[model samples]
Target: MKAVLIEADTISSAWSQLIYEIYKNGEEHKPDYSMSTRRLHATVAINDVDNNQINSFVPFGENLIKKYKEELTEEYAEWYISLPDDDKRKFDYCYAKQLFRYGETAYNTLSENLKNLRVGSRRHVGVLWENEVHIPKFEDQPCWIAYKLELLNETDVLLYILYRSWDAYGGFPANLPAIVEGFKKVFREKKLPYRIESLIATGWDTHIYESDLQAVEKIFKIAQLCPKCGNLTPKHALISTTKGKVCTQCKCRM
Candidate 1:
């Protein structure tokens, strides 16, 4: 587990810098920096309450940095991250930064998802998802799913799952939470874990909009980083074009 304590000028700037750092370093290369979550990006983030600024930090699986630390601004408050490799690039970044779980750092959102789902074996399953957040505050919809679990010989743990009923880029926030909460409720009643051995996601494409970039920034600014966990932030400034934002660091699309 690696950790980086990050400070930002307006919190937004800090997070933006952090996200750019991670996007550059992830395993997969996203040519379209603006659209790809795999690439560096920033979102609204929050640091400890003392000072309010966008909070963004990246984590490394291995000891990528040993005794590495620095203050970006002159007051030593905040600025874009900088490493020894270059004068312009910041070194901190990750694709998925696990924030907090049970007072400890989490690995990925999927990790907890697997835990709650309990990896059950099902003969068949169906998943329907609508992932858009309406601007006018429209009526809410729910995704429908069907599941049949074979328990022992005769007993069965049956369930239906939905990641999000609405259509939005940030579906994971609402959908993942719903799934976890549902799992908790079912686990209490059934006693046996609601095992979801298989999942059948509908043919869908999850994407980020240039218009929603600001919303993403605000989210990261408010989003808290889990201690000892990688907090991948998004880019602070992104103008949506058919062409994706290119990483100044890696010379790849962010």
Candidate 2:
């Protein structure tokens, strides 16, 4: 498997670079289904996750983030809270259940682990893929596998994410933010005195589908223009320009 390692100042920047690298150097291949692309195995590291620097490369904006947050963490109040865990393994797999809402959520489990952690402990981890449940079925199985949080010091935590496969265009953008946000919630609720030190994401198969090329090009264009505005463009909006890049509301005034 070919490899690409990207280190960027922000998650959006890292994601953009990953897409561009895959576009340029990814090997062409066919997938199990119709949509295919030049793909590669890669690991991405974002030193900082700017709440404001969400990438224009993503096809949609914060709404996508909201959707993913619910899917991955079920953070919203309107979520299906009463549904029982499937006993027969006959129901289709739901990633959120495996991650945050089954008998014991990954967040719940990790919080317990962190609370009991010692200064030099190595057990801060959460898992989303279970063999008995996922191995029997194929639909809606999780692409994200597991994550680990390592306490580096008294005031910082290092997060490592593992994805069995990732869709660079849509899934990754949503996955990264939702996971980070979920961690923040856990840390805060647990009252752990730790801030995110760094985030490292490893994906086995990361690729852009051929059909999404037009949207990808649009994102690249937006990334190029951000520097003109001091990089303050909102995470996901159909942006326009005045003297420089501005949000649609700002553009409306001009």
Candidate 3:
């Protein structure tokens, strides 16, 4: 069967209820559930995100965590550290997939020379970090990695990218402009000619958040809906969009 979309009309309605159960009920006072690690457990039904399925279970998982250790790679066992109570549920699913192929095929592609890289025999790991975004444009339901990296100079850099799945139902808008710029800077500073060779867009849930469903539709109205047909137009697909348009698909001048 072909992929279908999740129909989330009133998506944000559950947020308030979710917060109440975790805070007011003192879930910490309750006994443990099976293999469950989150401080809060509330099952939510989200319709039409993955497929045209009428209903699907959505769990609440969000947290703020800090990893202070020094290691470019981490064992799965390293998850025992403490995090903000809210983040546990979110991390569990985002991390627990068994069968996975990913956009980060470059996982080990960081030059081996860079690993033990040093300025005059001192060790350095080029790194960066960022969390707790203001305005949080993606509705915050989307999944991705956030982190800070320390340079050879002991200076920390901030990085926020939709690393794993760039095409989830909603993805970050503000994060991209900064990342493209950062991509240019890092390679230039390192004096490397390599470009971001492989940027794989996985899944199709990538979208910016809006307060209500109509606001979400309004974006489609501006981006994809053709004024002539009121139908989602092919001229609006990713490549057709540009700084100034001559549509890539139809070659129609904007």
Q: Estimate each model's TM-score.
A: 0.29, 0.76, 0.29
Which of the two candidates, 1 or 3, achieves a greater TM-score against the reference?
3
For model 3, residues 1-254, the per-residue Cα lDDT tens digits are 11222212222222222222222332222223322111232232222111221111112112111121111122221332223548644343222111011122313222333445333442322211123332354443224343222232332222222243232112222223223334434446567543432221122222222222344344345444223212233344434344533324334534
Better model by lDDT: candidate 2 vs candidate 3 = 2
The sequence of per-residue lDDT tens digits that candidate 1 reaches over residues 1-254 is 12233343232233443443432342233333333333222222223212322123322211222112112111111133113436544433211111111112222222233344433454433222213322342433232222223332223233333222222333322332233334334444456544432222220222233454566556566443322222332344333344543223223233
C-alpha lDDT (0 to 100) for residue 193 of candidate 1: 43
lDDT of 3 at 108: 21
Question: Which stretch of 10 consecutive residues in model 1 shows the poorest summed lDDT?
Answer: 94-103
User: With candidate 2 superimposed using the best TM-score fit, by how many Å does residue 75's alpha carbon deviate from the native?
Assistant: 5.1
Off by over 4 Å in 1: 1-120, 124-168, 193-203, 217-230, 233-254
Ranking by lDDT: 2, 1, 3
Question: What number of clashing residue pairs does each candidate have, in the order they appear?
Answer: 36, 0, 22
Pairs of residues clashing in candidate 2: none
Worst lDDT run of 10 residues, candidate 2, spans 225-234
Where does candidate 2 stray beyond 4 Å? 70-81, 84-93, 101-107, 218-254
Give the C-alpha miss distance for residue 103 in model 1, angstroms.
Answer: 40
- Which scores higher on TM-score, 2 or 3? 2
Model 2 vs. true fold: TM: 0.76
What is the model-wide C-alpha lDDT for candidate 2?
0.70
